[model samples]
Target chain A: MQLTGGQILCESLIREGVDVVFGLPGGAILPLYGTLPQYKDRIRHILVRHEQGAAMAADGYARATGKVGVCWATSGPGATNLVTGLACSSMDSVPIVAITGQVARPTIGKDAFQEIDVTGVTLPITKHNYLVMHASEIARTIREAFYIASSGRPGVVLVDIPRDVFQEKAEFGEYPTTVDLPGYKPVLDGNISQILRAARLIKEAQRPVVLAGHGVLLSRAMDELREFAEKTQTPVITTLLGLSGFPQTHYLSLGMPGMHGVAWASLALDEADLIIGLGARFDDRVTGDLKRFAPNAKIIHVDVDPSEIGKSVATAVPIVGDLKRVLKQLIANVEPAIHVEWMAHLDQLRREHPSLYIRPTEKLLPQYVIREISEVTDGRAVIVTGVGQHQMWTALHYTFKEPYTMITSGGLGAMGFEVPAAMGAQVGVPDRVVWSIAGDGGFQMTMSELATIAENNIPVKFAIINNNFLGMVRQWQEFFYNREYSASGYTKNPDFVKLAEAFGILGLRVTERSQVRDAIIKAMEWAGPVVVDFVVEEEENVYPMIPAGTSVDQLIEEPQMVEERR
Target chain B: MPKGPASHTIVALVQDRPGVLNRVASMFRRRGYNIVSLSVGHSEQPGFSRMTFVVNGDDHTIEQVRNQLDRLIDVVKVSDLSDENVVARELALIKVQATPYNRSEIIQLVDIFRANIVDVSPDSLIIEVTGDEDKVDSLLQLLKSFGVRELMRTGRVAMLRGANAYPGTPSANGNQ
Candidate 1:
């Protein structure tokens, strides 16, 4: 059948089983947008307030469903706006395909209105990118883009189409079953000898700890990870992104270990004899000083991405392959061993320095807010967060029971993520409760998406931890820069409840301590979308903290002055 | 930054693609590894190209770079030429300040290195030299004393001396 490039694009998406796409229309993208209506039944297009939101929502969708997310934008400004979101997705290994309209082929270099070298700009950030100069390349290019994005290590793939090409008629061909990417092969199966060597290491390790990371969720290898942990009786310490990889309530789960990690988790890392890094990169925040980090431990790193294997601390055993497959192979060959003493040691540490908050002085603590939310949701909601003190608070307080249940930007730490991302998560998993937990500062950055939420009618719960300050940065400044609060405080903040009301969401505020539970329940019962503005204690800092750039021993625990919180 | 020029030669096999070169160059740029010299051309394989570039970095930094480069989708295999005993050569075209006076002496110096006089003018002769960096460096040093006019050098292109090739190439198992 003869069809325009736009129709061919729709057909290609249909073949890929794409049910929904997020985007905004503009001058160069008009033709594709015109054809969008015809494929309305096949693909639902979510109109985001901005291109950044569209890209982030797509990322959120990808993370929630473990499927490649698709997003679109017009040329120039629209494409440029997507760069940040795409970069975040790239850094975090979320698979997303971003399509941008290009100025017509002839006008590409003429500095035409709304023309940009988007492919060139996005080259470094995206895993791969294509600029389709002809209509004939669209179907195959899109297919390749999707395949490349979703396979191997996931990342953003950009496809730029010139305006004229989208309208140009072209001959159609059967979608190729395979792409001839001669050099794109990824090692899926672990080398047997390497697996054996790693298994032996696990057997040998007396006080071993497993560092579970985002890759566990990406690979959906949490089950395998748990089995490996149980087989070896290893305690698990999750990275920030790896929060929900293993059940938070499981005995094996030592919780997150890092800069803002619980005292017990960080101590476990410091004291462990072996650290089996499962799908986790030993980022600087986690390993404060490389030489001092797990100084007594033998590191065994298992990850799908080969580059991450030795990028941080030198791994004694670096097994590069799919985590699920490698873990399976390992479980089959490894003999079960008991490390009761190590578990006892970890439990002792946990008891000694539990992540508890009873800051009696600070009336509405953020930790309290997270706890109440957790209490209301039963720790089962797909909780998403913008990067801040609140993110750490959520990680510290919330009880996550499953993989992919906690969605947050781990590596990039982009401020305004979860609002749009939570929407995408809600859209991806319609039956589940998706919550966007944002700090006041982060919420305002992309709060424009409140309109998008209203338009889509996506019932994503929004919990604004309205601290009236950039909490994380203020904490840093308070600790590091001698309390010089430079541009961190929000003196004249907008009334969040009124703002939510303006966006057609039932907005409720909980200022007093007694109002927390009632406000949460009321918002939870709201028919459609709800926003709860919990005006939390202004300066209640997240603790069990290793002051930035400090080693494990330098943890700033509870101070003696006044026994303030007690 | 004045980092000691720990010149390292890295040879990469990459699938020939429109922006592959830019991708490599950009990675180097991002890593703050200044490329000393770079050369790219078709490999023995049909659709693959070999790129050899020398960068200034310590061993740890270079290893990180090599591993990161291999992570790129288009890159097939990457090896540090300096790590292995290999056949290495660089081609240089040089124009020396030569008159009728002492012109034959310059030709003698070129001939000693097994170089060819690719071009000649009354005022100068452009000598083409192909050798390893040591040989090329020695020739350039000797010619500089004679007041060289201009010079251009390709970076080293390297291969294992005996029965070895890049991982997936036909001759990877053996030179044959």
Candidate 2:
């Protein structure tokens, strides 16, 4: 049967098992939107307030469901607005397919009203992209796009279709069952010799630390990672995005390691004899000073993407393949051994610089709010966050015991990511409780999505860590710029509780430390979406920070000088 | 060849599709990899194009470039021919200003370099030279004394010396 390009698009989406898509409709995409009613039972289209929200919601959906997420946008500004969201997913290796509408073929380069070179703009930020030339190629292109997005190291892929193509006719049959790209093959099994070499390193090392990254969660290698850590009795240090890949409550688990990582975890890395990096690139934030990072350790890097291995840190043994398969081979080859002295050393360091110490203060501290949420949720809620002091606080304070429990903007550190991402996660996994923890500065950036949440009744609990300033930047200014305060302070901020009420969502405000727990409990108990304004102390800073490019040894444990400010 | 930055040649077979070149060039630029020279043309396969790139980097940078290039969906195969015993050549056209006083000397120098005069004007000669980069540079340096007007060079193109790396039937190029 002959089908219009719009019908083919809906058909191909259903064929790819896509049940939900976050998008906004405009003039260029109206043809496709008009055909949505035909497949409304199979596909649910969520009308987003902004294209960026659509992109980030797709990212959150992918992270929560471990399946490819889909989003849509019209031409020009709609496509341009998705750039930051695309970069965020690209950096974090989230699998998302973003489809954009283009001007009709004849008017493409004539500077048409809403035309943009979307594929060109997204070239550097996407895993791959394609501009569909004909309606006949839509099915095959969508198939390849989804395959390329989710295959090895998941990433974002965009497909741009001309507006006229949506109205064109194509003879449709079955969607392509296979991808025929020759260069797109992903290596799954690692070299046996390299696995043996890594095993040898593991058996010989006395002080070994397992550094797990987001790849572990992406590849679903949590069990293999846990087994290897247990069999070797090695302590595991998770990167920020890798938080839930290993159980934080486990004795061998060290919370996070990096610039703002736990002091003890950074110290453990400093003194290790062997570092086994699983699916984690040694990013600048994670390594601090590359020259001084893991100076005494021999690194064995394992990753599915060959480009990521030795991209930052030098590798003594590099295994290029899936983390799950590589870990299984390593488990089979390596013998179990105990490292009592190493664990004891880490314990001593942890005791000397308690990772979770909170000063007894009557002021409503952000840390207290995060800790209270963690306690109330029993560490099982799917926690999403925007970038800032609140993000770091969530990473440090939340005790994650399950995989895919923590989703945040890691590589890009894009602010305003929490609101829509939380909505996406709640939609992806409706049975799980989802929370959007945001800093005051970051929350205001995308709070427009509150209307989208209310419309959909997304059931995401929002926790605004309202410190009335960009807390991270303010902390840096205090430490380095002599407390200039500059533009980081929010002098005239809108009341978040009142804003929530305006959006017709339940609202609560917590000013005192005692109200934090009750507000969180009340939000969680409510069935639909609720927003809690957590008025935290303005001057609180994330501690144990290895300032920018400094080594772990120069970690600032606490404030050095008390400034006299009212 | 030293421990610091060195030049490496990479060859890629890619689909003869629009924007493939843009994709390859964009990846190099985005990753901050330095490109010394690049040449591309239709390959033996009807649907494929061959691209040869001379990149300047150390071992890690070169590996990253090759990995990133191969990661492109349109790129079929990527190989580093820097270390192989291959036949590499570059072609250049030199338009040198020639006066009656130095015309004979310039012709003599071109003869010695085995270059042919492709075009001639009353006061200028365009010499076509095909050889390695060093040979082209040597001839360009000699003609510079005669006031070289303009020059154009096609970057390096190379193939392995033996028959091992060739596609299709063995000894297709009669090298075996």
Candidate 3:
């Protein structure tokens, strides 16, 4: 059938089973936007306030639904705005297919209005990118983009199309079921010999810890991970992005292991004899000083991306394959084993340093608020967060029982992630309760998305952890920089509740400790989007911290002055 | 696997497309891998380019370099020719200041090195030499004493001995 490139794009999206896309329309992209109405019934386009929000929302959707999230924007600033979101998705391995409209073919090199070398800018950040020269290549290019984005080691893929091409007519054929990419093969099955070696190592390991990461969620290998952990009787230590991949309440779960990670989890890793790194890169935050990082343990790194295998630490047995398939092979090859003494040791450490203990404070605490949210939702809601101390606190306190339940920017740590991402999550899974936990600073960065949320009535509960300071930075400054503050403190902050109200959403504020739970419940019950300004402790710091580039021995636990809250 | 930093040669078959070189160069720059020399040209297959990169790194770093290069979508296949029983050659054009007194002597040296005087000027002669890096280096060194005016060398390009080939190639694994 003869169709415009925009129609072909929409048709191909439908063929690829894309039900929704997050994007915004602009000058260069007018043709595609003009054609969007014809496919409105088949494809729902979410209009975001900023291009960055559109990309982030798409990322959120992908994380929540395990599908390639699609987003679109015009050229130049519109495409540039997506850089942060693309980088965030790339770092964390989220699958996203971002389309951008460029200036017409003739105007590309002439520096016409809204023209930019978008493909050039996003090249490093995306798994791959395409600059469509002809309208006929649109459908095929989009198919390839989606395929590359969702396939081996999922990541962001941008497809830049010239405006004239989108307006041009082309003979649209069947969307190719397969792409002939000679170099894009993803290793799905683990090498049998490597699996056998890993199995043998697991059997022989005395104190083994399973380092579960975002790959677990990406591969949906939670069941396999649980089975492996249980069969081998190993404790699972999750990374920040790996928060909800394993059930937090499970006896084997040691919670997150990183800078602001659980004290016992970090200690367990430090003391382990063998570490089974499942889809988790030994990031600096997780592994502190490499010289002192689990000096006794031999690492068995299992990742789909071969480049990630020994990028940081030395791998004893590197298994390059899909995590789920590798875990299956590992599960079948390995015999049931138990490390009774190791469990006892970890339990003792846990008892000595309770990870979830919040000191009772006169002022409302962010930890308390997060814990209350967890209680209110019964750990069933999809909890998303912007990066800050609040993100760490949420990971520490909130009980994540389901895979893909906790969504947050782990690698890029982009502050303005929560609002749009939560909206995307809610859109992706409409039945679930979506709570966006944001720090005061992070919330303000992307609070413009509040209008979009209200417009769609997305019902995303926004909880602003208001501390009047960039708490994480303030804590660092206090600990390292001699408390100079240095513009981290916000003196004249907008009333977040008022801001939400102005956006036509229900707004609530909770300052007193007794009001935290009620405010959360009120937001949850509200039919529309709700923003809760949780006025928390101004100087509170997330403890059990390993200062960056420092060894585990330099871990800072909560001060002895503050007693644990009940 | 070398214990210390050493020059490792990696050859990659990539799609002959725009920005492929930029992707490679960017990867090397961002990943902090030092590229000693790089040469790219059309390969035996149509729409494909072969790139030879001589990078300085230890075994682990070289592995990372190879893996990172292989990860690029445009790169069809990447093979490290460092450890292979392969034939490697580099072409260097050295312009030496040849005074009338030393002109015959330079000709004799070029003839001994199996090099050709491709271009000749009143004051200088451009000698083109194709050989291994060591031979090229030695030739350049000998010509330096004769006051080498300018020099340019194509980075080392290599191929496995006999029928030995990269995986997926027509001749690999005894495939006819």
Candidate 4:
């Protein structure tokens, strides 16, 4: 049937099962906005305040639903505004498709008003990009963009349509024109030789530990990981990104292992004889000193991305394939073994220094607040967190049993990611409880998304650990920079409760430590979105920090007093 | 440094867009691939272009060239033409100072090389020649004695003889 490029785009999106699109109208995109009304029943268009927020919302949607999130923007500045969100998605491997309208084809190189080379600008950050000057190519290009975005090691894809092309009439076709990419084959089967070698190492090792990462969650291999761990009786230490892979309450689960990871987990990683890595790249935070990280372990690295296998740490056996497939093979091939002595040692360490949270009777701690919230939500809620002390606290205190339930910007560590991400998560999974746990500083950055919650009536709960400062930066300055207190204190800030109420959402504030539980319960009880601001201690720092260039054994057990206070 | 002579040929496909050629050449320069000659033009498809680059290198150096070119995002496919293809040609335009004493001699050499005199001024004659890269180099070397005034050369462009194979060719995969 004959249709305009813009109409074809909307129709193709519907065919691809797209339910929503986040965007704003502009001069170059008028044709698309004009055609959007016809497909209004099939596609829900959300108008975001800014293009950056739109892109991030798409990212959040993709992360939560495992689908390619779609966002649209106009020409020039609007297209450029999606750059940060695109980069964030690219870094974190979130599947997103960003469509932008361009100036007419005739005016492309003449520097027409509101015209920028968006395809060129986004080239480096996208999986692939296309500039469709022909109306007939619109459906196909959008299809290709979605395919590229959602396939393999997923990332953002872009399609630029000229304004004139969007207005031109053409024969429309269903999306996914064709699936032919000769050069883009993703390896799914594990290399048998490497798997056998890994099994041999596992069989020989006296004390072995499994290190799971975000790849496991991305591959949805939680069941295989659990079976593999149980079969081998291997203790599993997860990176911050791998927090939700194994149930936090599991006896074999040695929680987050990194610079701010649990003391026992890091120590166990350091002492293991065999280290089987699943889906986790050894970031600097995880491997404080590469030379000292798992110094004595024979490493078996399994990851979907081949480049990640030996990029950071040397692997004795490198299995490049989907983690889920590889883990299942390992579980099937290897005989079950019991490391009674190793488990005893780990149990002793766990007993000695557990993940401790001091529940002060007078002042509220963020850890206590997180634990109470987790209990109140019944561990079924999806928790999104902003970066810093509160992020670490949530990682430590909350027990995430399901994959995609803890959706935060782990790779990017992007501040202000939680609120918008939580909103997107709530939209994706309407029935599930969603929580945005943020520090004071992160909450203020994208607090505008609070309006999104109110407008959509998404029942996402916001918990702001209001320490009245940029807590993470302040902690670093306090510990590493001799407490110079350079721009770390937030002496003047708005009342978040009032800010929430202004956005037409329920608001609550908790000052006394005793009010934390009741306040969280009340926030969750509100029908729509609600915000609870907890005034946490200003100087509380994340403990068990493995100082730069130091081994896990050299971690600071407790916060050190500033040698010279400024 | 062999100190004698070494050369290599590479063919690459890139998206048909402005600044793409410059990006490819600049990448070669940045990565230390010595280009002896380079050619670029539209390919079999409308929105795709092909580039052929000849560099002075030995086996090891040629391997490095292939590896470096593979890393460039704009370079869709890279093939070493030296080992795989036959039909290699470079176009050269040479302007020689043609005094009365040497004009006929230069013309005779041009005819022997099957080169055409495209332009002639009172003082200089411009000869255009298209042949295998070696033939073009030979002609240039012979013309140098007559006091060559100006020279412009296109990089070697090559195609395989009788379709033994090209990397991205449909026949190479036997899928078509």
Q: Candidate 3, residues A287-399: lDDT per residue as tens digits?
A: 99998999999999999888888889988898988999999999999999989999999999999985678886678888999999999898989999999899999999999
lDDT of each: 0.85, 0.90, 0.89, 0.81
Our tally of clashes for model 3 stands at: 0
Off by over 4 Å in 2: A561-566, B99-104, B166-176
What tens digits encode model 4's per-residue C-alpha lDDT throughout A1-566?
89988898888888777998888789999999999988889898888777877888888787778788899999999999888778888777788889999999999989999999897887667766778889897777677677767755677888889999999999874456675543345567787877787889999999999999888877889999999999999999988878887888788998987878888888888889999889888888888899888988989988766546555787788786777888888998898999999999988887877446454456788888898988887766788888889998888888887778787777778888877778777788888888889889988888888887788787989999999989989888877787878998888889888999999998899988889888888877778999988998888878767777888767765543223222
Chain A TM-score compared with the true chain A, each model in order: 0.97, 0.99, 0.98, 0.96
lDDT of 1 by residue, A1-566 (tens): 67888988999988887998999999999999989899998899999998999999999998899999999999999999999899999989999999999999889889999999998899889998988887888888888888889887889999999999999999887975678776677677777877888888888888999999888888889899899888888889999889989998898888988888888889888988889898888998899888789889888888777778767787788787788888899999888999988888888888888466556653877888888889888889999999988998998999998678898888889989979899899999998988889989888989899899998788988889998999988977776677799999999999999999999988888888889889888877776788899998877787877765668888766644214322
Please list the residue runs of candidate 3 whose C-alpha ends up more than 4 Å from where it truly belongs after superposition. A560-566, B167-176
- What shift in Å separates residue A84 of candidate 2 from its native position after superposition? 0.7
**What DockQ would candidate 2 receive versus the native complex?**
0.38
DockQ of 3: 0.44
The docking category that best describes candidate 1 is: acceptable
Q: What's the i-RMS for candidate 1 in angstroms?
A: 6.1
Backbone clashes for every candidate come to 1, 0, 0, 2
State interface RMSD in Å for all models: 6.1, 9.0, 6.0, 8.1
Model 4 interface CAPRI class: incorrect
Worst 10 residues of 1 chain B by lDDT: B167-176
Cα distance off (Å), candidate 1, residue B51: 0.7
Alpha-carbon error at A269 in model 4, in Å? 3.4
lDDT of 2 by residue, A191-288 (tens): 88888888999999999999999999999999999999999999999999999999999999988998889988998899999999999989898998
Ordered list by lDDT, greatest first = 2, 3, 1, 4
Order candidates by TM-score, high to low: 3, 2, 1, 4
